[model samples]
Target chain A: MLRVENLSAWYGEARVLRDVALRVDAGEVVTLVGRNGAGKTTVLRCLMGLHAGQRGTVELDGRDIGRLPTHRRARLGLGWVPDDRGSYASLSVAEQLTLPPVLRPRSSAERTGLAWSLERVFEAFPVLYQRRSVPASTLSGGEQQMLALARVLRMGARLLLCDEPTEGLSPLLVTQVGDILRQAKRHGVTVLLVEQNLRFATEVADRHYLLAQGAVAEALDNSAVRSRERELLAYLGI
Target chain B: MTGFLQNTFNGLVSGAFYALLALGLAVIFGMLRVVNFAHGAFYMLGAFGAYVLLAEAGVSFWWALLLMPIGLALFGMLLERAVVHRLGRLDPLYNFLFTFGLTLILQDVVKSRYGVQSSPYATPAELSGSVDLGLFDFPTYRVFILVFAVAVCALVWWLLSHTRVGVVVRAATERPELTRAFGIDVGRWVTPVFGFGVGLAGLAGVLAAPMRAVNPLMGADLIIVVFAVVVIGGLGSIFGSVAAGFGIGLVQSWGEAYAPPIVAQTLVFIVMAAVLLLRPAGLFGREESAA
Candidate 1:
């Protein structure tokens, strides 16, 4: 489980996230739906300790990791898939996959139950396996996204934090990503997603937190999001 | 033709030194993003380290060659921890200035101590004699330098490409944030990497002590040529540094033999300018992505 309380972040003098609070329980796919500059990505960055100017408490599994460094947070089982897909240009797909040393497992069950191997990742994204020896930069946008996701999974991340994983992806690839998220949920991987695509977010996420102007505006269950789809779309200005 | 062969061979020996120095520069620049103006100073210190070990400690040249780099490497680590690491978040120019100042201080210290004269380092007895290579008789020491430089370069390349440490280093080189995100303590590698690079510079210094006049200003003279070599090869490129080091060495030698002295003196810069005009990224440098 992850909990963020009164998270306030800034870029120099410009405050970007103000008193933003959100939480995600284990085995749930939660999404932060927002417009551009709604502080969703900033939220993720703050959580990952990538935002140096952030002030708040970020608790991962009841442990305060706010003061921990980015790498330390990662070693504590937090995996990030950035909006840019953050693939090393010179590294081959196989190299990228194998580069991350698996962090120490959170629990004994995590060690045995969630042993996501390279073979499993390869099986999930067959195209990645096909282009395993090729440089990640040579891959298509969709393939790069898949490689990004696959790499984090191979690192044995328990809590996956994704930023726009479906952005710029084709509908077919988006569907494939959705299936992968569903598969991940079944395997008990907690996901906190920042998404622009409400339709895709609703499909994959069990609950959604709509963000506006650097703060959480609404929290809705999957059924509430579906019933209030038109109202939510208008609120989100979609 | 025999004269040409002899000059070419001589060029290669000098090139080996250039390659060694440039390789260190490349590695330091690749990891730390520091220009490391003190690299030349480090090289000078390496040579002096050997000289001191021999004169004061009663150590032999062979043992100095083996032990001096390790000693200098520790010195380099201390330098990083004390000075270079502090400037990590500052503008790269701060690092440049800091290193430049360190270079001056180091040069002054050495000059004050040793009186700025070229000191002769005796070649090891095993490598003192000349070897006939059919085309010409070559100093056994020069041949040892060539073989040793190549072997070191090869080992470095293998370490960067094949080893897990290398993978982490390469990843950190390309994307530090992402590398850290993979749970690697990239900061922990910085000190050692800096020391390693400095050690290489020291190793070159030790190697050069026997061949060149070991002097206070030796590194100062060679650093410029090494910089030119790094530029022509591609800044921060491992392969480019080595190839360009050797290539420029050969070119410089050939020019010395064939071209006028003044023209030969400026030939390396001319080649560097030409390479820049043709490919601004150098032979092996990748164009940086637009921010």
Candidate 2:
């Protein structure tokens, strides 16, 4: 469960996010669908306490996380996967997977029940296991995405904030990402995803928030999003 | 053949000191992204620390060797916390300039206190005698310096490559944001890492005390040469700094034997310029992309 209210962010005098409000329930996959510059990434950064000039309260499990540092937020069970994948070029795949120390345990039984392990991650993405010793930079785009997802999972993150996890991924890799999201849902790891891909978003997310000009324009259930696909597609200009 | 061997041996002895100094520079530069212009000053402080412990406290050279680095490390940590920490958010050039100012202040203080003349440190009784190798006899202290430097370098290399702390340090060095996201407080490590780097510089100074004249300006002259070695080896490269330090030392030694004095003095700079021209990143250095 995460709640963000009246969140505003700036990049050196230029306001990017203006009074944005959103919420995600426990064990649910919620997506913020927007075109470029809709402030989706900015919202995630604000929630992570990474945006240097940010305003408004971000609550994780009813605790105010807005004032916390990025590392503190992470330690409180917030995991972020940036659009860039943020892989260390010099670190091996295994090192990247193992480096993130797990934060404090979540109180939710569903989250605590799942057996999150390196072996499980390897089973999910066998290609990573094969190239475990190889440097992260040497991996292909799809592999890097997989590595990014696997990394947050390794952190035992209760709430995962993923930005464009499927961007630049192949159709097969996109499908795999969909399957991973499904798996995450089954494990009760709540995901707040920022996506441009409507089809992928619809396939994975239980609810969708359409963002326009730095604010949430509409919030739609999965079925409503499917029925109103044409209008949403036109709005997204995809 | 004997003369050549003798020069090579001397070159290696000097190279050990250069390697030790450059290794510390590499670690500080790599982690903090600060050039640490005061590294040589820290080295000078290390030698002085040994001198103070010996002269005032009547501590033995052996004890000073162990105690000086720890004391200097604490001092370095304080300096980093009080001064360097403030400069982290500013341009790295600020830290460089700050350290340059520190070097000047430290050198001046030492000069005023100790006077401009070099002070001598006696060799430890155990390491005073010369050993006769087949080609020539060598001072026991020089041999100790060579062996001790190599051992220290190996330990540092192992610590960087093999340990968990080292892995975290290396990871943080490459990607601070991602490391933070992983719940690591990378900021906490900065102070200790800086102290450790300066401690290595101090250790080198302790090693140099018996061999070189312990003077305020001693580091000023050597720091330039060390910088040249770091440039040729590649900035922020651990192995590169070590290799280049030794390589440059050897080159300088051979030049002294084979070439004229002025040419010998200028040789390291020429090699540095060549490396910069051929590969701006240095041999082991990665090209830093604009952040």
Candidate 3:
């Protein structure tokens, strides 16, 4: 249940996202697929209110949150999994999970047991528990990605804005991430992913928005995305 | 070896100030990502505030110790709001340059009024005498300084690890943007944290007023060493800054004991160079730039 219209973002004089529009329904897994510099990350950043220079109205569950700060957006149920896998040097693995306060569901219908306890997070990713006391910076790439995903889920985010969750991850880790996404979707979490991996995107996402040069080129269901996978890969130059 | 314990004790006494000042630096850098060249000026203000309190208002040591930090915290918060936050969006070097300019102004303002002479401040009569140690007697105030510094460090450690405020502050300090995206109002913490960091520096200055020459240049000289201490300890790590502060003090003291005066002054820098060459992240720091 997120909607954006006439969203245009810029980096100084250069227009990165020009009048782009997209939507995602509640409990659905959606992806924005595009080539490098297609403004996928900017869209996520704008939705989170981190990108300052933008003109857009981001509606979450029929509420316009376009003017809210990043933290306010987060508290409103948007869980951000950044591309770099936000990890702090001073924070231990356990501290990272517990840092973000869990968001309470505003409506009874929104509750789908997606709110996870620390124990639940540990159960889902035992490696995090094993490395609980160590500095989060010490974790490997795959582990860091898991930590980022697990951190947002632990915070009870109803909507997940994930950026390249599988980038630089191994094949096994990619599979694990896909499973986690599927599981999240099953539990009624609405995820808007920015992914380059077409196969991975098709597997985890129900709908796809293909972005080309800062605008939405096509909105395709899973079948169309699967059928046009090779052409899309060539378009993305992957 | 003949006077190892005595030297160590002396080293720790000076180390106490480095530890306190470095703690503030670490915290401020973690949050603001600014080098804060004006931190020394704040320390000078603390000592000056205490001196002025005594000279102008007949306030005693006990009151000055209690009041200087609070007053400085308010002033610090005001400064943060008025000037520092404006430079936040630009390259970090702009703030660095601004603070550097601020330092010169602060130093000159004090100099214009009080002149460049070192002002004398009497240690509280209660802590003036020497204390009996098993091996050798040490000045009561020096012992108090060491013990009090350790206690403050411990209190800060406990507060950071055990309290809810500490966790939020720590998270925001270490990773501001990410913490915000996690639903934390990180901006709310910035001013207070800066105030707290400045208050810590002021507190150290209050303590120094009785022990060292109360002069504008005092902080300037001490801050150079403290900067080395911060680097050696790692940039934003609280524990690293404190530990490196004390460790560098010991190195400098031992150098003074066995080597020449110039060597003693440069010893901390030498150690810093070695630490940098070996561990670029400092002893306890993470490799990534904080946030």
Candidate 4:
């Protein structure tokens, strides 16, 4: 479970996320839907401690993690797949997967470990196994996305914060990503997604929040996406 | 035939120094992305470290060889954490500026401590004698330098290529953020890697101490030549550094033996200019950067 309250993040002088509040119970798949420049990515970044001017209380499992450095947060089971994929072009897929310092779970932390292996990820996306030896820069857009996800998962992430997961992929690949998200949810990994695609969000997310400017404009369960259609449409300007 | 053989032997010995110095530069450059103006100073200190260990610590040549590099490496780690880490976010030029100032400070400190007069660094009793190889005799020290330098290069190449921690370091060197996302603390690695790279420079200094004059100005004199070697090889390529180091060493050595002694130093610069003109990125520089 995670709790972020009264979070205001900034990049230089411009405020991106102002007084943003959100919460997710354990294993919840929450999609943040808004148009371009909706402060969703800023929220995720602020939580990860990448944004220095972020005034926030980002509590993970009831403990404050706002001030920890990015790597320490990662060890605490936060996986981030940035919008650019942040691919290390020189490294191979296999090298990326098995490379980092693996965090051994403590006695209480053992409950947080999800059972997913490299082979399982390869099975989920066979393209990864097929191009396992290929350098990441050579990967297609969709394959790179898969690699980005697989790499974070390999790092033993409990909460997956994906920024624009479906941004540049084909519809088929988008569906594949949706399947991957569904599978991630089934395995009890919480997902906080920033998405522009309403259809993809509706397909994968159980809970949805609409962000406008820098605040959480609306919070809707999956059913309200259809039920509260006018409110969602008005906010999205669709 | 004897003259040719002697020149060839001399070339290899000089190449060993090139390889040793360039190897240190490449490792630090790859990891830190800092041009390290102070590296030459570190290399100088390595020689000084050996000199002091022998003269002041009452240590023997062999023992100084073992301890000096490690001592310089620790010194390098402290420098990284205290000064270099503070300038991480600034333009890399700031780092160069900072290091340049540090270099001046180091050079002055050493000069004040031990006067500019070149201190003698004698070869140990065991390695002082020359060995006969059928046709002619070769100094034991020069042969040892060639063998040891190549062995160190091989060890470094193997460490970077095969080890798990090395793989992590290599990956992080290329992409720091992605490495961080993988739970690898680059903050922890950067200091030590910087230290190790400085340690290599120190080791090279210790290696050179017996071969050259040990003085404060030694670093300033040799660093420019090492930079030439790095440029001729390509900026950050380890393999290129190795090949260019040895190649330039041979060319310069041969030039000194056959050509005018006054132009021997200039010959290395001339080769560097030619490499820049022909390839621009040196032989092994990354193609993307060349364009």
Maximum-lDDT candidate: 3
Name every residue pair that clashes in candidate 1: none
- Docking category of candidate 3: medium
Q: For each candidate, what's the DockQ?
A: 0.76, 0.73, 0.79, 0.52
Kindly list the per-residue Cα lDDT of model 2 for residues A126-218, writing each as its tens digit: 999999999999999999999999998888888889999999989999999999989987987899999989889989999999888998899
lDDT of 3 by residue, B3-24 (tens): 9989999899889999999999
What TM-score between 0 and 1 does chain B of candidate 4 receive? 0.94
What are the models' TM-scores?
0.95, 0.94, 0.93, 0.86
Per-residue alpha-carbon lDDT of model 2 for B1-291, expressed as tens digits? 889888888998989988988998888887888888998999999898888889889998899899888988899899999999999889888998999999999999999999989888999999999989888998999999989999999998898777778878888888777688788898998989999989988998998898899999889889999998888888888899999988988999999999999899899998998899999999778887665
Using lDDT, rank the candidates from best to worst: 3, 1, 2, 4
Best by TM-score: 1
Q: Model 3 off-target regions past 4 Å?
A: A108-114, B289-291
Which regions of candidate 4 deviate over 4 angstroms?
Answer: A104-112, A220-238, B1-9, B55-58, B87-97, B128-138, B231-240, B254-291
DockQ, 0 to 1 scale, candidate 2:
0.73
Q: What share of the true interface contacts does each candidate keep?
A: 0.76, 0.76, 0.87, 0.71
lDDT of 1 by residue, B1-291 (tens): 889999999899889989999999888888888888999999998898888888888889889888878988899899999989999789889999999999999999999999888887889899999999998899999999999999999999999888888888888887888788888899999899999999999999999888888889999999999999999999878899999999999999999999999999999999999999998989988776562
In model 1, how large is the Cα lDDT of residue B285? Answer: 82
> Candidate 2, overall lDDT?
0.88
TM-score of chain B of 2: 0.97
Give candidate 3's root-mean-square deviation (CA, Å). Answer: 2.4
Better of 1 and 4 by lDDT: 1
